[model samples]
Target chain A: MPDTPAIEVRGVTRLFESRKGFLFREHTRTEALRGVDLAVRSGSIYGLLGPNGAGKTTLVKILSTLLLPTSGSARVLGHDVVEDSEWLRPRIGLVLGGERGLYNRVSARDNLRYFADLYGIPGGEREARIAAVLERVDLLAAADRRVEEFSRGMKQKLHIARGILHRPEVLFLDEPTIGLDPKSARETRKLVRSLVSDGVTILLTTHYMFEAEELCPEIAVLSKGRIVAHDTVAGLRQLVGGDRTLEAEAYGFDDREVDAVRRLPGVSKVVSEEYGPRTRLTLRLRSLQTSPDDVAAALPGHSELSVRERRTSLEDVYLDLVEEEAH
Target chain B: MTTVEVPRISRSRATSASLRLSFLMFMADPQWLIPSMIAPVVFGLVAFELFRGSGPYYLTYAILGAGMMSMWGQTLYGSGWAIGQDREFGTLEPTVQSPTPYVYVVLGRVLWNVISGLIGGGIVYLVVLAAAGSPPAVPDPVGFVVLFVFVMLTLASVGILFSAAWVYTRYSGFIQNVGEFAFYVGTGCMFPVVLLPFWTNPIALIFPPTWALDALRYLAIPGYVGFGWGFWPDIAGAVATTAIYVAIASTVFKRVELHVLSKGDLSDY
Candidate 1:
């Protein structure tokens, strides 16, 4: 890999104006990105881990030249995002997650072909490039199927095909696995790994910490428009220590109990996920001194609650940083 | 896998490629072709039947008016309404983000709409010809064809302009539908603009499509056929108006591009 960065962002900020209220009412301003600075080395998979509203997509948009930053600047392949956008655009590919960006009526191959032409792929080489990408994404068998007929996973694979069709040096994937089945998400990660191994730089954003841990060499944790922590997957896990964690499973849990657990002393973070009829809460305590008893005492319905000490995953690291601001 | 060099398309090639994709996208849903053909002929039939006793002029007038309506449909629905559809399809963000200038894609989209308008116009002419029992001949086919081409181009430019300007409103369908119907009646596509109340003539005259429709009448309608000032002015006015609208469209597109990029929301990205 080259020492020079494939993607560089310096002090980028984007402010969105809310268009609410009548003619005389003032428009409100919301800061989507606040002076974020990041850099990704060439031929590396860089993951941005954040919950929704963390400005991960905002930063991705600015770097992809889809949205312009209100202040500061971002550059891709050494071209200024705002100034050299026209020149820089062809050099990068983007997969904005969960949107029906492809023409549903057209076959997957045709969709890739159309984007191929737009990217300046000559007619002679376009077929090969399109097919290569489809094969890489494991969508070769369904290449001629209309995009609308494809499942969510298939559509995502097609998007991956389109992104890599031009052989871009950098690929921007925002929440690439948000709605995919496990097998599809696993396949996508494999494709991403292959692309990076081929010396293509990838910038990925996702709420799935394990996906980040599995696929990305480095992960940046963004919370409410700022980067709170950035490090390698294992290094991030060590921030809260893998051993000092508490897991609680409760029956018939609701938001009120979750909020109540969040306010308990020594509790630094809280992440809740529903499994079947029960809710699993992962809480990161302030220190090793904090105990499972402290958590059990805070439980709303103790009769049906179970608490245990466990090792921390990447999710614990993310929740620790983001919920720090929430508390 | 062997790595290949990043692709690069020339600016002209980009525009043409965009045109090809958008047209293919239209054809991909072949059902769309039906309404384009049906709307004009249906309108022509109703209008022609209403004026059956008037003379042969009724058939020529109904066919011409319906043809213009189809062209306007191309501008309104194909160009303007398509913008809304693109947004709904979630394709707008990707297209805008592509290296190719979005204006070219929009230009290409309108161009195909112009082509669809021609198809609709042809169907209207044939249907009216069959019903009227004779084909209405243009006194000067060359002059009529020349004017018709310019009229289509001018209307196309106007559609491109509307596509750009309507990005801000987000409700492109409602806006373009209102514009299409208003201009159809206002431009005298179904009747003579001069016959409209004294107040609407100036409003109708400002539209390039209105002037083009008048030029078409001068070329095809036997009683109105001529090479005089009455005839040449509409051609000149349509061409000049088209040029001005084209310039405005390009400038507005640049501004909107900047605005959307800077202030765009998540959905836009």
Candidate 2:
């Protein structure tokens, strides 16, 4: 039991059906998720990275018991998401950050109070807990102000505060730092770290690659409703090629020149892109044996040839995996 | 693994919290009271004007009719509108995701609406009394008052059931709007169901308010002959039908919650 994953999902697929047209209705079925399998360890921050419409939110909704999966199964804390939702509801906190979730006409404190009661926070500790979360999110000063008066960042903080009001064991944060200023975003990340330190498991979906690399020890890249890649950031870098990436640029590269660069030592994979008048060849190097000079030398006779190398980043790995899946 | 102990969920506490929250929201923007009161006031005045030269008991008929109409707005419309607002605010997702069953939350809103409906009914009573220049002759004033409260409860039961439809669909508000007058006619809010086609009586009897209103009129109006059933049968029918509505509401709310979860549209407006 101690080794059991905090969250486990198996062969999950979700399809959405929509109807349009007036006189003769047209029904459209979209596969939002297709056979997604994942496991998030206890007391860890797991990042879910995806492009728009990649089913990250759909997965979160299913795990949080807000939506039933069309097929397969998800379990949180050893409970089936659908069959054991009542038991799972209290243990999980979800923050689908947006302006609409909070009551705009009421004070921030009132919003928390309403959710606190809904979460069944004991009467004796409700106010103190609400105060603590507001303080943690750095919104204590504006607790009594109407939500409509707060900035977007402040509303986001209130959303996070409401999410953690009952001190859930597992928290699902869907784009939590979106629309936030740099300082507020940093503070929110710090709060996320603290929650994990307190033994909370977090499944954070974010577009910010650096945030994911910084906070999550492991991450899953979702693409086209599938978990295209799931590994540690370093592992993902290795999966794509290696820790080093080399880029060559010129007006354009002929096939022979591109092939010549591809055959160079330590080159694992090469991706070519056209930016208007210029072509850039991005090479993933598995070894340090290949230098920038080696890449430049392979494509000789081009006066405008340029080559550069840098350590591979999570963003590079995400792009590689997502782009590969697209092709 | 971190073991999590499930928190205790109290339906009563959730209901009370929902009630308090609704009351706070209502107070924050009490402007809604204006539009809600307009229909009741207009109906009360119109009914009183028509009944002015009739018999003395016509005053009772006008008050009962208009009072029922006012309570109908508050209990049924107000309760369903709360769910519609939840959809608009995107709060329905979190509220549904909470440990407490959603029906308790709706029950809380319905309770608040019941109180407001009573107030609305009192306002109608005052408006009609002012127009008539005197109180209606109630053979049993105490029975009339008790039966009046009972009618509101019957309406509240229907309100609970109706709120489920709002959860089931985003267009429930438009549907309710289209059916508002039909509901009034079907429930005989301003006129007795007996006045409608004799065949339509069975259809009207499906609504608990019909039976409850008939009972209220039986107590307030001296020569009232409702449904050819005596006062006790009407009361019994009202109780049975109200109990049935409450039962159906609980089951329907469960189904609606599951349906929305399946549709994944709890947040859809």
- Candidate lDDT (C-alpha), each: 0.79, 0.91
Off by over 4 Å in 2: none
Task: State the lDDT of candidate 2 residue by residue for B112-163, as single tens digits.
Answer: 9988888777878889889878888888888888888899899889989999
Q: For model 1, name the residue pairs that clash.
A: none
* DockQ-based class of model 2: medium
Model 2 chain A: lowest-lDDT 10 consecutive positions: A98-107
What DockQ results for candidate 2?
0.74
TM-scores of chain A, one for each prediction = 0.82, 0.98
Q: Each predicted model: what fraction of the native A–B Cα contacts (within 8 Å) does it retain?
A: 0.76, 0.75
Residue A142's lDDT in candidate 2: 97
DockQ (CA atoms), all models? 0.43, 0.74
* Top candidate by DockQ: 2
TM-score of each: 0.86, 0.97
